[model samples]
Target: MNNKTSSFLWNFRQLKLNICPFGSTSIRRLMKVDPLKLHKSKITYQSNSLQKPQSSVRNFCQGVLAFQLEGNEIQKRSLSTLTSTSVGKLLNPRPLSFDSQCFLMSNTTPQLAEDGLKKITDSVEHDLSPKEKQLDFGKQRDLIQQCNSMSDVLDVFSKYPRFSCCNYFITMWKIAKNMSEDQKRVERQLLYEHPAFKQLCDHVMKEAKIVRLQQLMFTLYAVIRIGIPQNIYLVQVLLRVVQERINECDETSLSVLSRTLETMEESKNVDALRAALRLLVDKQIWTIEHILTLQTMMKCIGKDAPYPLKKKMELKALKELNKFSHVNSQYMFGALAALNHRSLILLNECSKMVVANIHGCPFWMLMNILQSCRKLQYQNLDLFTAIGDYVTTTFDMWKMKQVLAFLFAFETLRFRHIGLMNMFLKRVLDESQSLNQKEILCILHIYSSLNHFHECKNQEFLEVITSALNTYLPKISSLNLLKAVYCFCLLKHFPQDPFNQLLQENIINELLMSGNESSKAENMLHQVNACLEFEDTSVLQSIPITLKECSSDSFFSNVEVEDVLLNLFENKRLFLKNVQLPHNYFVDFELRMDSKRSQVFPVSEADVFVAKPDILRVALLCVPRSAFCFGTTHPRGGLGMKMRHLKALGFHVILVHTWEIKRLDMNPAVTFLKTQIFSQEAFPTATEFAA
Candidate 1:
């Protein structure tokens, strides 16, 4: 395509995107002018369809996207140029134009500014909470919106002493958001020393007691969007005020406020936010009426939100899923993400919705659905194949972190579509220069987890990761470094010369002394040592950490399931309980039989290890509900790996998921076990023994 035609077609792609500011209004092709040279190229709106009733015409800038005013609302539209720079970079973030307090909810959404903030809607404007309803003074909002300069903003607040905290907040954001970054950062500067900012903070703090729910919510939000210029006092005050009036917040305001808290990077503020949000969820969750409100509540609860709160939300979400047809696709997707995968019914219902809406989901949303599937351990290849077909074509729009997340999810689910894997790996290779410490761990983990030991496909990435890790070794977390070493062992491609830096005294001690990971770290040490012994090519003079001798006994997470299985074996001598194996692997029960495998007899869990019982071992793994992913019956990566190693060591595995015991009576559970142990599928290896 020629440069002119290419630029013209780019407009079509933008118009096609639902997130685009122009809607369907951009590609009407009302008029086309001859291309002017370089930056002079422009598209002017001449048609009445582009104009608002009783409003003046608005023209778009030639090379940048700008917001247009129509009626009482501000709308986003397009103007394009085939410039040297890309269209996304050419656009600038629109200034604050909220009818409510959504601005703070999206600043940390991992999107560039131009994505969605340009078009604010009026739907979320809360009815002023009961206490502040009397302070809705006349014409204040209109006059403030009309102000064109900072001086005008200051003058309005000065004129109206009765104006509520809402007006005060609007003025603060208008003035402070426009200030350039350099002005805010210097140690001692005129902007920092200015009294106007201090005055704004003082007024908000003064009126905080009677501040409308709207203003308080947005006040907390604005601190996240653009921190108060030299005003930490305002943040601390806002937090204190939140605890007092937190229950006064309506459902939508509460959701927005909770989302804004996730963007707070400071640990101190995060702890406070978690405490408040958790308390509020406990108090208000029972009273929520609207389904969309529930959806917002589910979406706002971040990964760090209380665990019991997450369980409560999932129970509420599953009840709300019957109303899924009435919900928006985005809201449904968001609610579906919070579901615990223990319910196949929920996963099945949600997957139907997912497949139906798969083609319409954007790049990030699709990737999020996949990540949720990974977490849920939902390994329906049909769902994955459908998403893979769509996302593989729109690969260019994916951000680096999203790409890393998508690849990691694919590997975790153990669903290796050849084309999808190739596309993700190629993107990683193309963007290798930008990999950070965590990203390098992700890349290496994806590579090894998928068992991509091929020298040709994985060689370049390993070389890049090795060079990157050597630089990033000290920077990576102790947990992640251990995971990376485990990945190295999985691939058997550890670069001896560079990664020997992993065995440094300080690093080894950090790995050994990982507090919460003390038990797991011992397993990692054994894994690395086993790999080192097998490879027989050590750059290190000796193994770094000494292994402590211990019993190889595996314990059951759900002991009730074991009791049920024990009843099935009527003869206690027929089942060996909790046999621990090499490399931290454990089977709940093991049985040994003759080589012909005619009859099974119980061997002592200890005595079986004296001989090669893995050859005739009929291993029964009692996977708890938590061991499976959120919705599917499939075991998660960790348990699946244990089962895989058991099979590789010559055991014919018999599986028992917790649902079998939970959903079935003792008779049926016994029947299920007999079928699993006695009549195996023709292709047992091809089953979901790994996933």
Candidate 2:
């Protein structure tokens, strides 16, 4: 108890030095609590003779003035009566890891050993529980894995209350992670919330002296997988354990530790552990032989890793990639994903390798590979098709996350399997309740990108999603909300009454007013685009923000195709360039047909354009290469929406593929234009004269 208390004071004093070290803010944070309680405290301080840097004569005596310490019965005596740091340095203290003890001191020693750390049972001993006597560590681990339900596992725990710290930790973690998908989230939540789990955490806190490093590391990993580790007390203990004993960690442990701290980037507590992990990994990086550990280190450190470290890692990868291609599919996937579009040539070559040898890979790894290829935006048709086939045949085996990831890849890839999407739609609707916000958004993004608003069956899917989204709408970020609205508006449809109610004038005004410049501009654009699509002028009447007219409409003219067609038009009166239509659409060339179905003329020829409402209005669209799928003439979902929107606005939309003008000679282009403008059955009025 004394050693742990001294350790806490020492750490708090160290924190005081680094935190502010000098300013008035220094001591204020440690005692920013109720003034009434300070008056009621029994103990008082006396100034120390020493004049340290941040610790003033009075500040040096601070232990705790009884806010939480009073609750714990910790303020029994004054700090003036407490022993000096030099006297307390004689007591051995608990360390961040096992097999080492870093005692409380004013300063720490430099560069330590890299010996592996595991559990070291303390001197304290107690009689074993009957269940502990029956089930050894291996048996306990096996029982935890074999148990079907949380209650069964609790039965095991209730029987054997005491095991080695590491054994107890593994037992709890295995129980937490091993559950059916239907019960996975619910059961894990219940497990963490259970009294047993709370007791486990409390036991660790009370028995910090005896707990091992692996126990702390695995506890953190379990919480990350199970739920958010919001308990600052528990987290601080684990981090300090690592910080004080970091030098004793092997490269393997450091690699794992880096991966853990990677997620806690927001906390200041893990900074020391993170720095220690980096320093150790930098020296030991070359000795790493396991590909996945190396990949994990690179992934966790990411671009922040030193240039020398990154350069050596890449160089090492370059040698191992060739061997990984033939031996391990997972290694190949990691290699390609880690590179992440650095070399397009390698991306394509590795994609070809995946296509040739993807059959043996697991479904989880295969999903990652597919997502990696999609991320690189370099799709090999065979690779996507092969995996799609494999997933379709074994669709029942894939989890919802895997399905969501697979569908998300469709946003850019030219590939689509109708049967796959159909199965996915049914799966999504049935599992809609289980879907989280991001997962639901991925589904909407995919379907919207495919222009599924026109599909009847997708309506119910949207409804389920809309209902689900409305419940969690306020909790979602601005980017996701905008994305949701964009998906619905792009598809020319939206959701239920509640979702519609959120678009009330005041709500929209608040969104625009409260957000950043980019968010405000984007929200305004969505409002403008939505007004154009649905013709809801009421929503636009009093909008707090306005986007530029051009910003509201994403489309721009394809200059190459437009120029070719403009040169073909003998008279500028025949067509207009950059014409704006009713629904925020930009027509590259707008031509009209006369009453006799013979002549084509620009709107300038019309004395009153509204009078000839019966006449055919043509939107001569110049579709750019980027608007289509790579290596194919198939239009992407966004381009399809444009053409659909034009048709909705009552235009006889005509598409001129950019490649036709860019790739072909003038004579061939002229022939193509003639066929496009005047049908074989129609009288050639402008086509004949233009030729």
Best by lDDT: 1
Q: Write down the TM-score of every candidate.
A: 0.55, 0.55
Across residues 1-691, which tens digit of lDDT does each residue of candidate 2 receive?
5544545555466555633234344233332211112122121113343243243222332432211122213222323223223211111212222111111111222221111111112112324445456767786677667776565565566555565444455455566566566676777566655656555555554455345665656666654554435333455665665665555666667667766765665444454455445555666766777766767766565544556555666666666666554434444455445534244554555667766776666766776776666665666667777777777778898887876677666556756655677788888788878888888788778776665432456678778878878877768765567667766655555454333444456555556566465665454355435444543334332324344455525667576665566667767677777776543457787778865556776667343235466588776777766665455554565666566556556666676776777888877887787677766433223222111
Point out the worst 10-residue segment of candidate 2 by lDDT: 97-106
The C-alpha lDDT values of all candidates are 0.58, 0.56
Q: What tens digits encode model 1's per-residue C-alpha lDDT throughout 341-404?
A: 2446666677677777776576667766677766655667677777766667776776778766
> What's the lDDT for residue 28 in model 1?
32
Distance from true location, Cα of 660 in model 2, Å: 9.2
lDDT of 2: 0.56
